[model samples]
Target: MKSNNSLTPSYFQFTVFADYGPLRYLFFSLCLLIYMIIISANVVIILTVCLENSLHQPMYIFICCLSLNSLYGSAGFFPRFLMDLLSDTHFISRPFCFIQMCIIQLYLGHELTLLTVMAYDRLVAICQPLHYHSKMTFRTMLLLLMFVVFYPVCILIYFFYLASSLPLCGNKLHRIFCTCWTVIELSCVDTTVIRIASQFCIVISIFVPLSFVLYTYLRILLVCRRSSSDFRGKALQTCLPHIVTFGNFCISLCCEFSMSQYDADEVNSSAIITLSLEFLIIPPIINPLVYGLNLPQIRKVIFRFLRINQT
Candidate 1:
């Protein structure tokens, strides 16, 4: 058995899917609807930000980046997911599983960094109105965007390097998609080193951005309180959508994290699936809607784009 532990399996079995009977088609239809909506909504936001010169500002640009990340993440998950919904076999090849894991982790990492960047942008715009433009220069925006993207990829390269070197004793993944932790759990060797490294990375990946974002919001709220009602309203208008998106992202991730960290054998399988997919399903759909409907600048431009196309 120890000798076999050194060998990587060709594929992994996903034990999450059940016999939904004929309802599998229903599940497929609903998920397909969701995937389409995610694609359409995110594409609109990305296009809106690109075409509108006014929305080329830092905030809207960050929002576009968020939408782009959503698309990236969804593409990684939903195609495989939608297929698994109707398929009898749910096995994924080792290489493709790693690819999916990379996409998802990068998506998660990019999201946190991007949100933190958005918070910093709002903090500067609201708290230090005079220095906002000078501080958030075009060059700075590009740099920040680059950081949001490659920081996670770099971290994952190191982490996956460690993960890939490990020899696996099992091929069963308890969830629909691959995550680093879950895959690591299948290793036959002691995972103490990997576990500690992953925990450290998790803190850096998840908590650091969240803490900074919270600090920024706290500062903005304090600033809003000191200002007049009109100023408060304007600040809220700009920040509300971001706050909602941030909150939603956190909640979804918490649910997914809880499921991943614990043994969920006794829990209902339907509930398990919901918890697993919640992180991927909710945020992508909600992000574009929140920013599209709540932010006046985006809402106005989206409407104008629609009206122009109607003519």
Candidate 2:
């Protein structure tokens, strides 16, 4: 049992993956399989969307963006994670840790921003159907892309700046990888400013996308009231998957906030488990599942492709 103070540059530490014997291996294995599914499914989406030009509308473009973002995030976390899971050497170089944190945050932040953008795209499509094409043109897409890249870049810079200020004390990162707040906590120096900055970032980043989703849905509901019954049902069905994905994220955020307060020792296995669920697993898994289960076009293509492959 290592205390927070016991961490040193030479020591290897990892977040509590599992405390029970078989459960650790089983959980890690499960996560590995889920990660693979995430990668494979997202890759399919990207390729299918790009090659099938019929899918190259504003909606599909946003889907491609979301898939790519998920890939970027999963790629950052999963490889190093597999290594850490299998090996006793959990210690990572400080620079490497910073790199991990930056890449992860950049991708994850972009995912959040893209979701908001997508929600807006949906809003335009549903609420101002005639203007959707004009409103969400290639130029508009490019502008949104710029913002997506820009905000995440700013987040990365801020993370590095605040991370650099933190004293290494001992370079043991408790997590499988260098998470932003996790790294921030290890600093022995005054972390009040950094902590405050991070909290502000979290609030803004979390709420903006959340608000976008909510507002889009609210308008969508109003539009539905005016729409024909069939149109209303179809529209609601299309939006259901996004709503579920967003809901999962909201749950994860709440878990993260709660877990942030508990000491590692004080944090029960169930508590930690709850915190890990959505962040590590949901986006990758949910993206594919939502698309496959809810979107008939994608599922038809997937099935057709699979049948062709089997032949």
Candidate 3:
């Protein structure tokens, strides 16, 4: 195995650790296809939502946030992943790894925060339709955005500070992308606080938002039962994408968490492959497919755009 013993005094750093052999080719191809589709679809969604005045509501605003966050999150890692795979290089420099981890965490944190806000928005719209206009205004959205962005930055800054302060022992990352927890795991010192911090972050990011979304959707469904069929159908359709996205995310997270456990001998190939699919491949590939394939508006927009381009 290659090592991180040698070091240069340069402030800016770059490292390559491409040791996956033939799997690199497979990974590069998969990442390229998924990255292209995700970027194209997310860009179209955001632009269409922006261009159409009718879509400038709280629901679409949250959709835009989801699209933008996924776009940024996937773009930040996937392109480099493909590039590194193509070049047969998997190592990331300390600073570059930090930047990548920060971007990933920031976008993910935005996703969680936006999900919570979306739940609240749904609650207001469904439970208090008369006051939705007054409640989910532009100013409220802006505040929510700030909070979402700020909370993640603070969390990451502390993580990077702690991570960088530690003396490095090993730097060979098992996965393609640079994750904060994985990087922290390679640290020489005790990571008790880091472990606790990570657990706290996961609980806040996953369960709290999950709980709100579940509660809001449950209440919405209950109320929908009393409404006309047409109204009920529309409400259910609006919530389907959210439910699907959350489910996929939860599955991927569980897979990731499982793979983080290791035997002292080695982490093994099967676990790595499983974790890779869950973390790197599935979310980017499946999320847009789930949301885009189901949504009538997105399908119509995509078809129209393709037809216009062909003509």
Candidate 4:
């Protein structure tokens, strides 16, 4: 048998749907279109929030953060994915694979943190209206924004550090992109420490925020039930979009995790590819649309801009 060091590869091959043949072009075209839309829509949201003074409030600031996160996350995945679609041989350099994994993980972590902050923002706005302004002050918002962006990056730096120390036994990645778990599985050494750390990170990064979102929404629902219809309508108008976005994102993430954990040999390759890409593809597209269409201020700003550009 070859030595483990010798067996380790310098590059990883993506074997997901590599045999699609002619259909690869079709998939490439579709993905490129969606990616363009994601970029365009998210840019609109960021620019709209920046240009419109009326949207300088805490809620809209949160929306802007969400849009930025969408762009950040999509940037990590779509470009490489599109490139892979057009390539006959889908391989990534070992260093680039680790870079990609870190970026993708950062995106996921930032997204959940931002959403959790948004949920808290909504909770304050609806449940403690008078305190909303005081609680979500400019200083507070700035701090939260910093935390959202940096917290994930800090965690992922350590994650990559741990991953980098391990000696690999193999280098063939089964999925379209590199993930920490997949890379960990390729290690020749024991991964007990890495596994324990990953579980802890997941709980702190994903589950805690998810729980907060659920709790905040539940409280909002209870409060809405007792309030006047006008108040209820106002609450619904603001909170409904957040709820929808949250639900869609959570479901997509669940699908991603489930597919990642599933028995790859038993599952269809196409299905695995679809599930793997869902969280990356769906949320970025859905989020900007949901916010832009549902929020009247944003909708008006978008229309006004469109009309100006048309003239």
The candidate that achieves the highest TM-score relative to the unseen native structure: 1
List residue ranges in candidate 2 displaced over 4 A: 1-12, 15-28
Weakest ten-residue segment in model 1 by summed lDDT: 258-267
Ranked by lDDT, the better of candidates 3 and 4 is: 4
lDDT of 2 by residue, 1-311 (tens): 55644443533356554444555577679878988899888888888778776778877778888888888888877887776666645667666777777877787678777777778887888888899888899999999988988987876687778666655565544445677677667766777877777778778878877887898999999999988999898887778877887777677666776676554567775656555656867877788678666877777777777898999
Q: Model 4 shows how many backbone clashes? A: 0
lDDT of 4: 0.85
lDDT of 1 by residue, 34-99 (tens): 999999999999999999999999899999999999999999999999999999999999999999
**Which 10 consecutive residues of model 4 have the lowest summed lDDT?**
257-266
Error of 1 at 79 (Å): 0.4
Runs of candidate 3 with Cα error greater than 4 angstroms are: 1-27, 263-266, 301-311
Model 4 regions more than 4 Å off: 1-8
Sort the predicted structures by TM-score, highest score first.
Answer: 1, 4, 2, 3
Question: All candidates' TM-scores?
Answer: 0.95, 0.87, 0.84, 0.93
Q: Which pairs of residues have clashing backbones in candidate 1? A: none
By lDDT rank, best first, the candidates go: 1, 4, 2, 3
RMSD each, Å: 1.6, 3.7, 4.0, 2.0
